[model samples]
Target: MSPRKSVAEALSTRAAILERSVAIASAEGLEGLTIGRLAGELGMSKSGVLGHFGSKETLQLAVLDRAGEIFRAEVWEPARPAAPGLARLRVLCEAWISYLERGVFPGGCFFVAAAHEFDGRPGPVRDAVEARFDAWRGRLRKEAGRAVDAGELPGGTDPDQVAFELLGAVMALNHALQLHHDPRAPELARRTVQARLGRPAAVTGQVHRDPPEPTTAPER
Candidate 1:
């Protein structure tokens, strides 16, 4: 094959590996990933699979990165167009719940699984997992702070506290889903978040209402 074609094929193969790796890691922890299994599943030789990522740790890290991309696409991107503050935050919460309900990761939330798997292990893998969660919570806190500044939330409201509550609800959702296989878990999570956030700020141009007639019917 020409050099360009070879490079294209290599990229394609790498993409395939990451795709499979994310799904496997989601359901079975990152440790479950192995060259032999991936090669057998993808019909590639062990060397070919290993060639894409030189080491198991490297492959695990790559899987975390790929899973983060998928998370952004499925959850974050959908909420991007909403007006910031409570409106955007509400959209984000909804999208996040839907992402889990839709099984984007096959094992529920990839980061959640990763966090549980690596929360204690002290290593690069654990650091990567922690970083992902930190970014998510940071975004939540930023939006909550925006809501406060915009007067959508009470002035005394703590953005980090809000982030913690929201994260707790979704974390419970993942637990219910993976443990009890509860069908109502998503609905419960949505309600919990909505109650905590209260009413979302109405988006301008989202609805139209006719002008109200005068109480005294004007001069008629």
Candidate 2:
């Protein structure tokens, strides 16, 4: 077999640069993230950082994609195992708020921060960030529909509206927790989502658990 790829392999190189971009963008907004700044912070040569991304816009898009991947892993995946209905809805909301509360980045949510930065700026970066934002909105609608299908939520619920509200709630708490670094705002957001979905206020996080086995520990 061929030798293993180097640590600076193409994919690894891109990932490393994207991670650095995310950190810079999160702290100082996208404007503050430049090829030079990233290279300087990462202690890599300017040409080294440029070699991976090729251009500033490409780097921004890469950072946005990487941030979305991070969000899905930390927030979406954990909440996915929850029963696809009210239970799942609560889990998803709590997962979102808790992620922001934990301060995954110094600046708050990567998506939320990026939205404001790129929102009116015309370019690939704006398109990419907006697309990522809308993707979460769509995911929310799908989950909300599951709730209606199971009769866990009131019938005739508007998936679009519910999706919008959940997004708003997450953003509201994201703003507060990041600006003030207060625990209460995040807690309030989490509880509000639970209450809206008729879930208990325990915030157990048990909803994200694996499905139960058919039998308790196979008989010997």
Candidate 3:
């Protein structure tokens, strides 16, 4: 093959490998991804799979990167155009729920599975997962701050606290959907978020204009 053809083919093969790697990691955790298994699944030789990533750790990191791309495209980008403040935050949360509910990954959210799998392990994989989580939480916090500034939320609201609670609700949603097969988990999560943010319950399709009341709700 010509040099151009060779480069094109190599790129195509790499994309295919990464695509399959993401799916496998989502369903089986990053540890379950092996060159032999991937090669067999893709009908390629182990050497072929190894040639692209060189090592299992590198392959896992690549899969994590691919998962992030998928998340941004499917979840973040869809909510990016919404006006800032509560509107944008609400859209972002809805997009996230939709992403999980629609089965973007065969195993639900890739990061959710990976987080549970690698939470105790200390390695580059764990670092990557932690970084993603931190970034996501930071974005949520920033949006919460914006909402506060816009008066959509109470002026004294704690953005980090709000972000924390929202993240917790999402984590619960994932667990309920994956472990208990709860069909109402997403709706419940949406309502939980709406209530947390001082918005009217989503089931009513109404917005509350008053500031959120102080409550002794337990932190999730």
Candidate 4:
């Protein structure tokens, strides 16, 4: 094959590997991603999988990066064009809940799974997860601050506090879906977030929102 073709093929294979790795890590945690396991799943040799990633740590990091990309695409991109302030923030929260409900990851949220897996361990993996979370929460706080400035939320409202409450609702949604398989978890989260932001009751009505489309990603 031409050098360009070889490089293109390599990139394609690597993307496929990372995609499957994200799903596996979401369901089984990053520790479950092994060269041999991926090789078997992808119908490639162990050395082939290792050739792309070099090591388990490198593979884990790549999966984390891929997960971040998926999050931005599914969660952030959809809400980016909404009118800035509480409207944008509400759309962001709804997108997040939809991301989880749609099963973008087999195990719900990749960050949530990886965070619990590496929360106690001191390593590059944990650091990567922490950094992603910090960025996410920071965006939430920034939007909340904008809402306050726009008078959507009370003048006395603390952006950090609102971010915390919204983040808590997401955590609750993850727990409810993963533990009990609750179908209402996402809607419950939506209502909780709307209440926290003080959106009008008529706007938060159940009939107003459509359910998230089911995801094509693999399930556990």
Model 3 C-alpha lDDT per residue in residues 77-166, reported as the tens digit of each score = 655666666777887788888887888888888888988899999999888888888888877888899989998898899999999998
Candidate 4 similarity to native, TM-score: 0.90
Tell me which residue pairs clash in candidate 3: none
Worst 10 residues of 3 by lDDT: 211-220
Candidates' C-alpha lDDT: 0.83, 0.74, 0.81, 0.83
Clashes of each: 0, 0, 0, 0
Question: TM-score per candidate, in order?
Answer: 0.91, 0.85, 0.89, 0.90
TM-score-wise, the better of 3 and 4 is 4
In the range 10-85, model 2's lDDT, one tens digit per residue, is 6776777788777888889878788887788778889988888788877777777677777776677666687666
lDDT of 3 at 129: 88
- lDDT (C-alpha) at residue 182 in model 1: 98
Alpha-carbon shift of residue 129 in model 3 (angstroms): 0.4
Candidate 1: residue 17 Cα off by (Å): 0.7
Better candidate number, 2 or 3, judged by TM-score: 3
> Candidate 3: lDDT over CA atoms?
0.81
Predict model 2's lDDT versus the native. Answer: 0.74
lDDT, model 2, position 147:
82
| CA deviation > 4 Å runs, candidate 4 | 200-220
